[model samples]
Target: MTRTLVVIGHGMTGHRLVDTVRDLDPAGHWRVVVLAEERDPAYDRVRLSAYLEGHSRTELSLVEPDFLTDPRVDLYTARPAVHVDRKTRTVRTADGDEIGYDALVLATGSRPFVPPVPGRELRNCFVQRTLDDVDALRAAVRGGQPAVVIGGGLLGIEAAHGLRLLGMQPHIVEFAPHLMPTQLDADAARVLQRGATALGLRLHCGTAVTSVDAGPDDAVRSVTLANGTVLDTDLVVFAAGIRPRDDLAVTPDLERGERGGFLVDAYCRTADEHIWAVGECAAVLGRCHGLIAPGYRMAESVARQLTDHPAEPFDGTDTSTTLKLLGVHVATFGTMPVRDSQAVEVTFAEGTTRYAKVFLQTSTGTLLGGILAGKTGSRTELTPHVGRRPPADLEQLLLPD
Candidate 1:
């Protein structure tokens, strides 16, 4: 008899697990059932902001047209798995249906965190996550008034640029001292700030929003800052961050991380041997990985183990990131801050056109990590050399060719 595998949450990592499993297990050892809360199938949530640039829904979808037609795999959209009963090895759906499973995988992903502020629920206040959220924001943007984005991280900058493209004056309000604070150092962030400003975005760094005030129509009229400054706005977009979805953690025997994700072993196995967790929902080694690359790696690892193939325990993922935001190139790899005592650093800036920094082991000259802002031409090649020594001299490596 074939085993039943129930997978919850049809996000990118979830879909990747299913695809990987199907490709490896062509013998049909396990039948798969996927439960997704969203009506649409898995799509590229990383490129979600591209929707504002005229990318269609189908273009962003990660689902293949013939994926659901496989007899071994069954996908249920808009049907969320509400309860997990380890006693019977079954999962209860929101529609009052319970499906028995031999193995369970939770890939519930994460939800946008809206800060606790007054009038946040008022009209025109939105969080950019799913296609539905972006579509609603697209329709609501009339493009004359100024829009305030509550975060200055990657998503916040993307939201600001999207709104700017819609003809609204975009203002980025960041609680941190600089933009992309987690990814780039102070000097690199400064370069990114100039690029953002040149792209027509207004920056408000080291500021916190005290409260959101609404008008008589229950729509956002203005936002007040902690420093006693008020700014008028048309809409408020909250891109603060995300919280892992661990709703099923209430079930007995299910372990959860302190920071709100399912606690799993290096093998991606939960407390119960029959259950496993992967992607943003899974916390490995006490921390949850929020990047897509790490999530993909986790999915592949779990798929290999389930298919009875040789697999290595997931140690940790490289937090290196490279992306273009608002027509500005930004890349950071290895460690963001050189915290070691014996660390050597090099910096070079070509007027207003570029700024680059590289960290090396002081004694051995091994490349540890670095940041490149403004005209990151060799980011692709340099990223792979993150933990290794550069091929050439440090001076030649930092030069903009």
Candidate 2:
């Protein structure tokens, strides 16, 4: 008897699960169906900003033809899955196709959060979340137009950089006081801001767009800020924040977080034992890990258990991350954000705007977390220390007094 497996949401995490399952059981005893809401089979959402910045889609493919002439896997693109009835163990699609499954994986992923500001519905106002969203933003900025991006996170910075490449003046409006606030400490954030500015991106820190104004009836004229300053723009791109897609979590017997993410066990099992979910949609250890590595681990474990294979429960991971924006490199790892009250601490911060900061625990040498401002070159190598806090020599190492 062939075991059946159905994966909803063919984002990177979903497709990766399909491939991993096939590898774990090469005998072809598992039926894999991947339903993607996007029109094209999954490429890579992590590099979507790169595509928006002018890179070709072929550069970001995990698998060229999706299956490359293999028919064992069935992929449905632009098709949204509507209902999952655990009673019958079936998933119905928006396209009127019902798929019965022995087991299910939900990788519904996350969506860009657009705040309810006035005039957001105006033409040329866009949200950059998917390839479709990127394409629309590109189309909105035709003929060397200027664009204002809302949010200063990784996606927003990437979108702004990409927009600049297309000859669109890219400007960022951030509610936070600095760039990449969540990823980098205050000093590091300022350093990153300077790097972007050197690249010709306008940074509006501690500022937010209150309303969008349509020039005529067809395009955005400008964005009105809380400071009453209007920056003229031909297009508006919202890379604001991400919210887990949990439209299906409202049903009975399902556990969900206050912020709209599904609650899952260490094995990635939902409240319903027969069903499992991973990726951004599932919150693990009281945190929704938005990185790719964690989501992939979740998927691998869920599939293994269902097939009667050895499965490792997610013992929890030390969340550490490092990434490059335009040309600036920045990193954050492990327990860097812990309140100083719990751990011995050492710090060094300096910049004209006071850019870089590195936090370390005093007594027990742990990487804890680091913040980089002007030059984040050390972050790439030092980030791994975040998971396992290294020596307190971090202060003397990064900066010699």
Candidate 1's displacement at residue 165, Å, is 0.7
- The reply for model 2, stretches above 4 Å from the true place, is 65-68, 249-253, 307-309, 315-317, 348-363, 372-401
The TM-score measured for candidate 1 stands at 0.95
Candidates in order have lDDT scores of 0.86, 0.76
- lDDT by residue (1-401, candidate 2, tens digit) is 78678888988888778888877777778878888888877788888877876777677677656474556688888988988888888889998888998878889999888989988888888887777788887776665666899999988898888888888888899999998776766656766777788888988889889999877565688999998989998788888989888786323446776666778889888777767788898877556777787888888887687666899987554555667776766665555555644555454655533334555556665556655544433655566566466655665545445
Model 1 residue 61 CA deviation in Å: 0.5
For candidate 1, list the clashing residue pairs, or say none.
none
Highest-lDDT candidate:
1
Count of clashes in candidate 1: 0
Alpha-carbon lDDT of model 2: 0.76
Best by TM-score: 1
